[model samples]
Target: MGEPLGFNEYSAGKAIVIELKGRFDASVALPVKNRMRSLLDDTPFIIADLGQISFIDSSGLGALLASLRHASRRGGDLRLANMTEKIQQVFALIRLDHVFKIYPDVKSAVQSLKE
Candidate 1:
Protein backbone atom coordinates (compact mmCIF):
# COMPACT_ATOMS: atom_id res chain seq x y z
CA MET A 1 0.00 0.00 0.00
CA GLY A 2 1.09 3.55 -0.59
CA GLU A 3 1.69 6.05 2.16
CA PRO A 4 -1.38 7.78 3.51
CA LEU A 5 -2.22 11.02 1.79
CA GLY A 6 -2.45 14.18 3.86
CA PHE A 7 -5.01 16.92 3.46
CA ASN A 8 -5.45 20.17 5.32
CA GLU A 9 -8.17 22.73 4.96
CA TYR A 10 -8.16 26.47 5.54
CA SER A 11 -10.97 28.88 5.05
CA ALA A 12 -10.13 32.13 3.30
CA GLY A 13 -13.24 34.14 3.95
CA LYS A 14 -15.89 32.25 1.97
CA ALA A 15 -13.50 30.09 -0.01
CA ILE A 16 -12.24 26.76 1.26
CA VAL A 17 -8.62 25.96 0.49
CA ILE A 18 -7.69 22.31 0.58
CA GLU A 19 -3.99 21.55 0.62
CA LEU A 20 -3.12 18.10 -0.67
CA LYS A 21 0.16 16.40 0.10
CA GLY A 22 1.71 12.98 -0.54
CA ARG A 23 1.00 10.66 -3.40
CA PHE A 24 -2.52 10.45 -4.75
CA ASP A 25 -3.32 7.13 -6.37
CA ALA A 26 -5.99 4.45 -6.39
CA SER A 27 -5.62 3.56 -2.74
CA VAL A 28 -6.31 7.07 -1.53
CA ALA A 29 -8.76 8.26 -4.14
CA LEU A 30 -11.86 7.18 -2.23
CA PRO A 31 -10.78 8.93 0.93
CA VAL A 32 -9.96 12.09 -0.97
CA LYS A 33 -13.31 11.96 -2.71
CA ASN A 34 -15.21 11.51 0.53
CA ARG A 35 -13.42 14.34 2.28
CA MET A 36 -13.94 16.70 -0.64
CA ARG A 37 -17.59 15.69 -0.92
CA SER A 38 -18.17 16.50 2.73
CA LEU A 39 -16.48 19.87 2.41
CA LEU A 40 -18.45 20.84 -0.67
CA ASP A 41 -21.71 20.25 1.13
CA ASP A 42 -21.37 23.59 2.89
CA THR A 43 -18.83 25.55 0.91
CA PRO A 44 -19.71 27.29 -2.31
CA PHE A 45 -16.14 27.54 -3.54
CA ILE A 46 -13.18 25.19 -3.31
CA ILE A 47 -9.59 25.52 -4.35
CA ALA A 48 -7.47 22.38 -4.36
CA ASP A 49 -3.87 23.26 -3.60
CA LEU A 50 -1.51 20.77 -5.17
CA GLY A 51 1.81 22.40 -4.31
CA GLN A 52 2.85 19.51 -2.09
CA ILE A 53 1.32 16.69 -4.05
CA SER A 54 4.31 14.57 -4.99
CA PHE A 55 2.65 12.17 -7.32
CA ILE A 56 -0.60 11.37 -9.09
CA ASP A 57 -2.12 8.68 -11.25
CA SER A 58 -5.28 8.05 -13.23
CA SER A 59 -7.36 7.51 -10.11
CA GLY A 60 -6.16 10.80 -8.70
CA LEU A 61 -7.12 12.62 -11.83
CA GLY A 62 -10.51 10.93 -11.79
CA ALA A 63 -11.12 12.06 -8.24
CA LEU A 64 -10.38 15.66 -9.22
CA LEU A 65 -12.69 15.50 -12.21
CA ALA A 66 -15.43 14.02 -10.06
CA SER A 67 -15.02 16.77 -7.52
CA LEU A 68 -15.24 19.40 -10.24
CA ARG A 69 -18.44 17.90 -11.53
CA HIS A 70 -19.97 17.58 -8.10
CA ALA A 71 -19.17 21.19 -7.20
CA SER A 72 -20.48 22.51 -10.50
CA ARG A 73 -23.76 20.61 -10.23
CA ARG A 74 -24.41 22.23 -6.88
CA GLY A 75 -23.81 25.74 -8.26
CA GLY A 76 -20.41 25.87 -6.64
CA ASP A 77 -17.02 25.84 -8.33
CA LEU A 78 -13.79 23.86 -8.06
CA ARG A 79 -10.38 24.93 -9.25
CA LEU A 80 -6.87 23.50 -9.15
CA ALA A 81 -3.81 25.43 -8.06
CA ASN A 82 -0.07 24.91 -7.70
CA MET A 83 -0.05 21.68 -9.63
CA THR A 84 3.35 20.13 -9.91
CA GLU A 85 4.87 19.74 -13.34
CA LYS A 86 4.09 16.03 -13.38
CA ILE A 87 0.44 16.51 -12.62
CA GLN A 88 0.25 19.45 -15.01
CA GLN A 89 1.61 17.25 -17.76
CA VAL A 90 -1.04 14.68 -17.11
CA PHE A 91 -3.73 17.30 -17.32
CA ALA A 92 -2.32 18.58 -20.56
CA LEU A 93 -1.99 15.11 -22.02
CA ILE A 94 -5.55 14.29 -21.15
CA ARG A 95 -6.82 17.67 -22.38
CA LEU A 96 -8.20 18.36 -18.92
CA ASP A 97 -6.11 21.48 -18.67
CA HIS A 98 -8.60 23.21 -20.89
CA VAL A 99 -11.60 21.72 -19.19
CA PHE A 100 -10.91 22.90 -15.65
CA LYS A 101 -10.02 26.34 -14.41
CA ILE A 102 -6.42 26.27 -13.26
CA TYR A 103 -4.44 28.95 -11.48
CA PRO A 104 -0.79 29.49 -10.71
CA ASP A 105 -1.55 29.71 -6.99
CA VAL A 106 -4.30 29.33 -4.46
CA LYS A 107 -5.07 33.01 -4.22
CA SER A 108 -5.64 33.36 -7.93
CA ALA A 109 -7.75 30.25 -8.14
CA VAL A 110 -9.96 31.36 -5.29
CA GLN A 111 -10.30 34.83 -6.72
CA SER A 112 -11.29 33.44 -10.09
CA LEU A 113 -14.12 31.51 -8.46
CA LYS A 114 -15.56 34.71 -7.06
CA GLU A 115 -15.72 36.32 -10.52
Candidate 2:
Protein backbone atom coordinates (compact mmCIF):
# COMPACT_ATOMS: atom_id res chain seq x y z
CA MET A 1 0.00 0.00 0.00
CA GLY A 2 1.00 3.58 -0.51
CA GLU A 3 1.32 6.15 2.23
CA PRO A 4 -2.03 6.81 3.75
CA LEU A 5 -3.38 10.33 3.47
CA GLY A 6 -3.31 12.31 6.71
CA PHE A 7 -4.73 15.59 7.95
CA ASN A 8 -3.30 17.77 10.68
CA GLU A 9 -5.38 20.80 11.61
CA TYR A 10 -4.23 23.99 13.26
CA SER A 11 -6.30 26.93 14.40
CA ALA A 12 -5.10 30.42 13.64
CA GLY A 13 -7.45 33.14 14.79
CA LYS A 14 -10.52 32.82 12.57
CA ALA A 15 -8.75 30.66 10.02
CA ILE A 16 -8.03 26.96 10.15
CA VAL A 17 -4.98 25.45 8.56
CA ILE A 18 -5.23 21.87 7.42
CA GLU A 19 -1.98 20.18 6.53
CA LEU A 20 -2.49 17.49 3.92
CA LYS A 21 0.07 14.71 3.65
CA GLY A 22 0.48 11.89 1.12
CA ARG A 23 -1.47 11.29 -2.06
CA PHE A 24 -4.40 13.61 -2.73
CA ASP A 25 -5.87 11.78 -5.66
CA ALA A 26 -9.23 10.19 -6.32
CA SER A 27 -8.90 7.77 -3.44
CA VAL A 28 -8.99 10.49 -0.82
CA ALA A 29 -10.87 13.32 -2.54
CA LEU A 30 -14.30 12.42 -1.21
CA PRO A 31 -13.11 12.08 2.33
CA VAL A 32 -11.16 15.29 2.10
CA LYS A 33 -14.20 17.16 0.82
CA ASN A 34 -16.41 15.72 3.55
CA ARG A 35 -13.95 16.69 6.25
CA MET A 36 -13.68 20.22 4.94
CA ARG A 37 -17.45 20.51 4.77
CA SER A 38 -17.74 19.79 8.44
CA LEU A 39 -14.93 22.14 9.27
CA LEU A 40 -16.64 24.90 7.34
CA ASP A 41 -19.37 24.83 9.91
CA ASP A 42 -16.96 25.98 12.53
CA THR A 43 -15.37 28.70 10.37
CA PRO A 44 -15.37 29.40 6.69
CA PHE A 45 -11.76 30.49 6.60
CA ILE A 46 -9.67 27.48 5.63
CA ILE A 47 -6.08 27.08 4.54
CA ALA A 48 -4.93 23.90 2.88
CA ASP A 49 -1.21 23.36 3.38
CA LEU A 50 0.09 21.20 0.61
CA GLY A 51 3.75 21.00 1.48
CA GLN A 52 3.51 17.31 2.32
CA ILE A 53 1.09 16.33 -0.41
CA SER A 54 2.90 13.73 -2.51
CA PHE A 55 0.41 13.51 -5.36
CA ILE A 56 -2.78 15.04 -6.68
CA ASP A 57 -5.25 14.44 -9.49
CA SER A 58 -8.31 16.05 -11.03
CA SER A 59 -10.47 14.67 -8.28
CA GLY A 60 -8.33 16.34 -5.66
CA LEU A 61 -8.58 19.64 -7.50
CA GLY A 62 -12.32 19.25 -7.72
CA ALA A 63 -12.53 18.59 -4.02
CA LEU A 64 -10.67 21.80 -3.33
CA LEU A 65 -12.83 23.83 -5.69
CA ALA A 66 -15.98 22.47 -4.12
CA SER A 67 -14.74 23.33 -0.68
CA LEU A 68 -13.85 26.80 -1.86
CA ARG A 69 -17.34 27.38 -3.16
CA HIS A 70 -18.81 26.15 0.08
CA ALA A 71 -16.68 28.54 2.04
CA SER A 72 -17.54 31.41 -0.26
CA ARG A 73 -21.20 30.84 0.26
CA ARG A 74 -20.60 31.21 3.98
CA GLY A 75 -18.97 34.64 3.41
CA GLY A 76 -15.44 33.33 3.81
CA ASP A 77 -12.73 31.99 1.56
CA LEU A 78 -10.50 28.97 1.20
CA ARG A 79 -6.79 29.53 0.80
CA LEU A 80 -3.90 27.28 -0.20
CA ALA A 81 -0.37 27.33 1.11
CA ASN A 82 2.92 25.50 1.26
CA MET A 83 2.63 24.00 -2.19
CA THR A 84 5.60 22.13 -3.61
CA GLU A 85 6.99 23.04 -7.02
CA LYS A 86 5.13 20.23 -8.69
CA ILE A 87 1.85 21.16 -7.09
CA GLN A 88 2.36 24.79 -7.99
CA GLN A 89 3.01 23.80 -11.55
CA VAL A 90 -0.12 21.75 -11.68
CA PHE A 91 -2.29 24.59 -10.37
CA ALA A 92 -0.69 27.04 -12.73
CA LEU A 93 -1.17 24.75 -15.70
CA ILE A 94 -4.79 24.26 -14.83
CA ARG A 95 -5.30 27.99 -14.19
CA LEU A 96 -6.50 27.19 -10.71
CA ASP A 97 -3.87 29.52 -9.39
CA HIS A 98 -6.20 32.36 -10.32
CA VAL A 99 -9.12 30.69 -8.70
CA PHE A 100 -7.35 30.30 -5.36
CA LYS A 101 -5.37 32.62 -3.17
CA ILE A 102 -2.13 30.77 -2.66
CA TYR A 103 0.56 31.75 -0.19
CA PRO A 104 4.10 30.55 0.29
CA ASP A 105 3.40 29.35 3.83
CA VAL A 106 0.64 28.76 6.30
CA LYS A 107 1.49 31.83 8.36
CA SER A 108 1.03 34.16 5.41
CA ALA A 109 -2.15 32.45 4.41
CA VAL A 110 -3.59 32.91 7.86
CA GLN A 111 -2.49 36.53 7.92
CA SER A 112 -4.26 37.25 4.68
CA LEU A 113 -7.54 35.93 6.00
CA LYS A 114 -7.24 38.36 8.90
CA GLU A 115 -7.21 41.29 6.53
- Per-model lDDT: 0.87, 0.92
C-alpha RMSD in Å of predicted model 2 compared with the true structure: 1.3
Highest-TM-score candidate: 2
* Model 2 poorest ten-residue lDDT run: 1-10
The 10 consecutive residues of candidate 1 with the worst lDDT sum are 106-115
Q: Clashing residue pairs, candidate 1?
A: none
Listed per model in order, the count of residue pairs whose N, CA or C atoms clash below 3 Å is 0, 0
lDDT of 2 by residue, 58-84 (tens): 899999999999999999899999999
For candidate 1, give the lDDT.
0.87
For model 1, how does the per-residue alpha-carbon lDDT over 33-59 read when each residue is reduced to its tens digit?
Answer: 888899999896789999888888889
lDDT of 1 at 90: 86
Clashing pairs in 2: none
Off by over 4 Å in 2: none
